[model samples]
Target: MVHVILTHEVKDFFAWKKVYEEGEPLRTKSGIKMTGVYTSVDNPNQVTLTGECASAELVYRFMSQPELKAAMQAAGVISAPDMKVLNKV
Candidate 1:
């Protein structure tokens, strides 16, 4: 399995959470299995989402969709996301 670490800004914790919850079905449909998620204690807007996937390519494909990008932008994630792909030790 491949692991993905996504760092992005969160406009509002509750609002972003709503978006995350709303996207749960899509995540599953795209072959993502969420391992965990984190938000900065000092700055709630900074979020890190960790998940396992069959392929990094697949994850990128799903997240790069126009609708997904638009939703993220609406949520106040202004900058391009930083994605870290990992492998199990």
Candidate 2:
């Protein structure tokens, strides 16, 4: 499995979490598995998460979807997310 680390800022962490939780089924259908979420110690609006997926390629494809963009926007993502995929060493 490949893991992706994603970081971004949200207008409101709690509101964003509500949307993220609601979107779990969509992610599962796309073959993405998520871990517990996280935030900066000093900045609750700054969010981060690690997700496991079949491949880095799948992660990019899922991220590029228009619906995903819409969902992110609705979820209060205020910045373009930075994501990196890693394979266990």
Candidate 3:
């Protein structure tokens, strides 16, 4: 199993959440096993999303989409997200 960590900021939490929820199907079809999303304790606009996927390669496929990047930018994400890939020993 692989863990994918994504950290990003949005202009509005509720609006961003709507988009995320709407995109659930695409992710489900893409082989993400499970996912958990959390908001920063001190910053409402910031979010951390952790997903358990079949493999690091699958996770990379999801993150490497041009549409995803454009959506993030259009949603007012000010900076590039920080992505961390991890594995359990």
Candidate 4:
């Protein structure tokens, strides 16, 4: 299994959380099993989503979709997301 970590800052964490929750269908379709959602210790606006997918390709494809960009915009994400795909060493 591959792990995907996507972190970013949002304009409003609560608003982003609402949109993120509504994206369950998208994540399911992309074969992404989200394991956790987190916020920075000092900043509630900083968000991180952690999950597992079949491969890095799946993650890239999911991230590249226009729907995702739209969702991010709607969620008020203010910064470019930092996404990393990693396998256990």
Candidate 5:
């Protein structure tokens, strides 16, 4: 399995969450098997998302899609995202 970790800052958490929910179909279609979300206790706008996928290549493709970038912009993401893909040992 492949694990994806993403961190970013959003202008509004609620708005970002709404946009995120709207992208469920795309995410599923991109081979996301499971996901978990977390927010920073010190800064609510800081968001972290972890996803499990069938392969790192699939997750990388998903992240590179133009639609995903548009979605993030529409979701009010105010900062560039940090992402990492890991393979299960």
Candidate 6:
């Protein structure tokens, strides 16, 4: 499986979470198979999201989508996210 990791800071975790949850259908349709979200213990505003995707290409496409960027902005993501794509060893 392909894995996608994303880390970013948000203005409000709960608000961002609500928007993230609302994007489930879009994510699924874009080829995400499963997803997990976590917040940093040191800083609650720092969030990490991991998703299992069918392929790295799909994940790349998902991340590059304008809609996703707009949604993240609306969700209060305050900084550009760091992203990584991995393949299970």
Evaluate model 4: give its lDDT: 0.94
TM-score per candidate, chains pooled: 0.88, 0.96, 0.87, 0.97, 0.94, 0.94
Residue-by-residue lDDT tens digits, candidate 6, 1-89: 78888899999999999998999888889988657899999999999998798888898898889999899999999989999899899
* C-alpha lDDT of residue 48 in model 2: 93
lDDT of candidates 1 onward, in order: 0.83, 0.93, 0.82, 0.94, 0.91, 0.90
Best by lDDT: 4
Q: Which pairs clash in the backbone of model 6?
A: none
**Higher-scoring candidate on TM-score, 2 or 5:** 2
User: Which model, 3 or 4, shows the larger lDDT?
Assistant: 4
lDDT of 2 by residue, 1-89 (tens): 89989999999999999999998988998899998699999999999999899988889889988888999999999999999899988
Please give the lDDT score for candidate 6: 0.90
> Which is better, 4 or 6, measured by TM-score?
4
Please write out the lDDT profile of model 5 over residues 1-89, one tens digit for every residue. Answer: 88889999999999999999999999989988657899999999999999899888898889889999999999999998998889778
Number of the candidate with higher lDDT, 4 or 5: 4
Where does candidate 3 have its weakest 10-residue lDDT segment?
A: 70-79
Cα displacement (Å) at residue 25, model 3? 1.2
Error of 1 at 58 (Å): 0.7
Residues 1-89 of candidate 1: C-alpha lDDT, one tens digit per residue: 89999988777777887778787777898899888879888988788899999988989898878877777866667557899989889
Candidate 4 lDDT, 1-89, residue by residue in tens: 89989899999999999999999999899998999999999999999999999988988898998998999999999999998899979
Give the 10-residue window scoring lowest on summed lDDT in candidate 2.
59-68
RMSD of each: 1.3, 0.7, 1.5, 0.7, 1.0, 0.9
TM-score of 3: 0.87
Q: In angstroms, how far off is 2's CA in candidate 3? A: 0.3
List the candidate 6 regions with Cα displacement exceeding 4 Å: none
